[model samples]
Structures are given as structure tokens and as C-alpha cells.
Target: MLAQLRQQAILERVRRTGGVRVAELVRDLGVSDMTIRRDLEALADRGLVEKVHGGATIVGAGSTEEPGFTAKSARQQAEKEAIARHAARLVRPGSSVALSAGTTTWTFAHHLADVPELTVITNSLKVADVFHRAGRPDQTVVLVGGVRTPSDALVGPVAVAAIRSMNVDMLILGVHGMSVKAGFTTPNLLEAETDRELVGAAQRLVVLADHTKWGTIGISTIARLEQADVVVSDTGLSGEARAALSEHVGELVLADPGADEREAPAP
Candidate 1:
């Protein structure tokens, strides 16, 4: 497994067991003790884990964690950028797309400015601003009016009702967190409702999230895993995560900083 993916697995193991022994990881992952130590050390640097004498334990872990846009934007920058680029490839010119609110989708909005003759609808003020700043006459940008959350998402009955009124070619979404069981989710309940409306309005659902989001469950479920047409995430996702996502999602696209998006072999 890739080093980053290994680290993710280690972190998950630590979260589950509260701590993981180096010997167990070595046996389970079929890696050297030194390699496991290095993975633990790297996770420690990110404050995700705390290294003990022979293992590491989760640090300040909780499922209810929800960071604001600014806080989330600071994380997984390279991963998010690569995911955005790969997601842009899936967009055709002159098609309508809806974007749900979150930092990753906001980053993707920056990429969509160049796609010609597009109609963009979003519940995110930041996303609308990206297109508005471009001031493209050929592209139509619609900002749905509603209550804004700490994540800068406009969510409420107004947003959901407005989203139900239009159909789009694609819906590119960003979530607070996601998991095998919970699927794509948001921390805010109303945002989840609004996102569901957006999902129903699109023919294709493309979710853009980094590796860190894997196995993290939020407050509300937007859709089951099978509902997603595609999931674009970082290569740092563990083998187990990739397998689960492949089994559930229609397409699993892993973004790498240096290469084109990698896809699982189709059955």
C-alpha cells in the first residue's frame, strides 16, 4: 500500500482500538516495524494520533467534529486541487451543474470558470462569487437564496424548494463527512435536506471529498452510497476504503498530484 494510505489505515485502527501495537500492524499489513513506526510518526505530526512507546492512539477524536470553511480549506489543499481538476474533466461545456456547499466544492468552483457556456446553480455564496467574479456572459450563475450556515451553505426550505424547481446535468457535492453506512453527509440537518434536493435535481451525482473524509460520519445522511454516480477522492485513501467505495459507488476516481485520475477496474 502507498505510505499515505497506510497511514490512513493506521489512524483508523488507532481510532477503533484507542491504540495499536506496532507488532500487530506489522503482522496485519505485512510491513516492517520501521515502516509502521514511520506511519505513526507521520500521523502524529498531523495531530491525528499520539505515539506511545510501541504504538499510537487517537487524539481528540470525535464523530461530531465540524470545521468551518476556512478551517477545512486549510486542510488537504493539494488533494482538493487535484480532485477539482479531475472533476472538471467530467464536466462538458454548455451543460448545467449544481454544486452543494463545502470547501471542496468551493475549490471546484474556481476550476469551472473556464468551462464554456455553462449554467451553474449553487447554495454556496462562495461558489457563486467565483463565477460572478469571472463575469462571463456565456455562463449563467444562480445563487439560491436561503439561510447561510457556518460553512457558508445556504440551506433551508427556500433552498430546497428552489433546487427542486430545476434539473441539472450534474451535481458536484462536498460533504462534511462520509462513510460506508452513512454515505455522503453534512453536519447540519437543514443543509442535508437542501443537499438531498440538489441530488434529486441532477442526473449524475459526483462527490468531491479528500481522503480524510472516509469513515467520518456526519449528523445527517444525504444519500445512500449507491446513489452516487461517482466519488472523487485522494489517493491517500486506504485499500479497504477504496474497495468499499468501489463496491458501493458507480465509479471511484482517485486523484494524484502528479498523474491523471486513477480508476478502479470496471466489473
Candidate 2:
């Protein structure tokens, strides 16, 4: 496999199991031991993992580590796409919307890029680019300006100030993690602040996340589960997760990545 793809696979394994031994990666990937070490080193340099004597562990076991956009976008590809499709159905044409930064929200942006007379306000450059590429004349995109995070989100005071003045029909949020206690969270403090601003600007909040995000906690809490008008995730979510989210969120929607444009039956 190419180095990028190989690294992504290794990263996924580590994230899934919380760590991976070099021997295991070499045996599973069919790469040299030295190659495995190099990949581990690369991931470590990006703060995505912590290199140890014989293996690597996911960075920020405390949930403060922030992965770059490229690394995050490679994961849960099918799940993100599925969640995006289901979330898109909630939007109506010509309505103003706010999209928070994250891979899932970026995927959701593509599904809405061509909606007629829609106005989009966002802190994610990636989401803005999706609309730009669609070249829809009737769409207006407002790219909030601020310092960019590892996740390609514009945050800090400038972004927050811009969002506070506007009101949207709905806000599509993508979070780093979600739990019954922590609700929705992100590792970056500034990004969390900006996201809170986005939340306040919208009449309704819809969060898009894959099942892997469950139980993962970030350093900062963006909002509680009850703040969400809807939470959309994949069928991969655990039954416990569905029950908790269903109780707190206004609605819990599950998408089936394996099915063609179908939502998983609600719990």
C-alpha cells in the first residue's frame, strides 16, 4: 500500500484497539519492520500517536490530542457519507444554515452544495470549498475568518464574532466525541468556543457523527446532548448509545452505510 494509505490503516488500528505493536503492524500490513517504525514515527510527529518501545498508542488518552484534517478524513469514510445523506434530508432549499468543521460536516456540505438560494455560514474551509466547487450561482457561502485548527476549522474571536451576529435556520455540527456526560466535545479550545457561537446562531442544532465518536471525550465540551435538536449517526452505534442519545437529544437518527440511501431503524 502507499505510505499514506498504510499510515491511515495503522492509525485506524491503533485508534480501534488503543495501541498496536510494531510486530503486529508488520505482520498485518506485510511491510518491513523498519517501514512500520517509520510509519509510527510519522504518525507520532503529527501528534496522532505516542511512540513507545515496541508499539504506538493513540495520542491524548486524556482526549486533548487533535488530529489534522487529512488524518481524520480518512477514517469512517462510509459512515460519514451515510450520516451526511440522512442529515441532508433535514434541510430545506433556500434556508440559511451553519456548518461546523469536521469530516462528517464536510461530507454533509457536498449534499447541500447545490440547494437553490441557500445561504451557508461556516468556520470550515473544507466545507466552503465544497460549495465553491459546486459553482451554484444561487448559493451564498460565508467563510468565517479566524485562526485555523489542525482540523481545518477557523476559530477564535474573529470567527465567533462573525457567527454571533447571524441567525440560521439550522446548524449542522460535527464533533470530536460525544458521551452521555460530556455531551459533544472537541479537543481544540478555540474551536469549541467558535462552535458554541454557531450553536447560538441557529434555531435548531443537528449533530453529525459516526459511531466511533461515542465514548470519546475531548478537553472541551461544546454543548450538552439536550442542546441538540437531532443527532444523526450510523447503525454501528451501540444500543446503549442509541438509548442515551434518544433520551437526551430531540431525536436520534441512524443511517445505514451498507444500504443504498436508507436509515437504520430507530431504537
Clashing pairs in 2: none
* Model 2, global lDDT: 0.90
> Model 1 — TM-score against the truth?
0.75
Q: Put down candidate 1 lDDT per residue, 1-267, tens digits, no spaces.
A: 999899888877666546677888899999999998888888999899776555665565455555555445646777888999889999999999999988789889999888899999999998988999988899999899899886789999999889889999999989877788898887788889999999999999999988888988888999988999999999999999999999999999999965633444556
Give the number of the best model, judged by lDDT: 2
Candidate 2 residue lDDT tens string, 82-197: 89989999999999999999879999999997579999999999999999999999999999999988778999999988999999999999999999999899989999999999
- Residue 144, candidate 2: Cα error in Å is 0.8
Q: Against the true structure, what is each candidate's TM-score?
A: 0.75, 0.78
Which residue ranges in model 2 land beyond 4 Å of their true spot? 1-61, 261-267
> Which sections of candidate 1 miss by over 4 Å?
1-64, 260-267
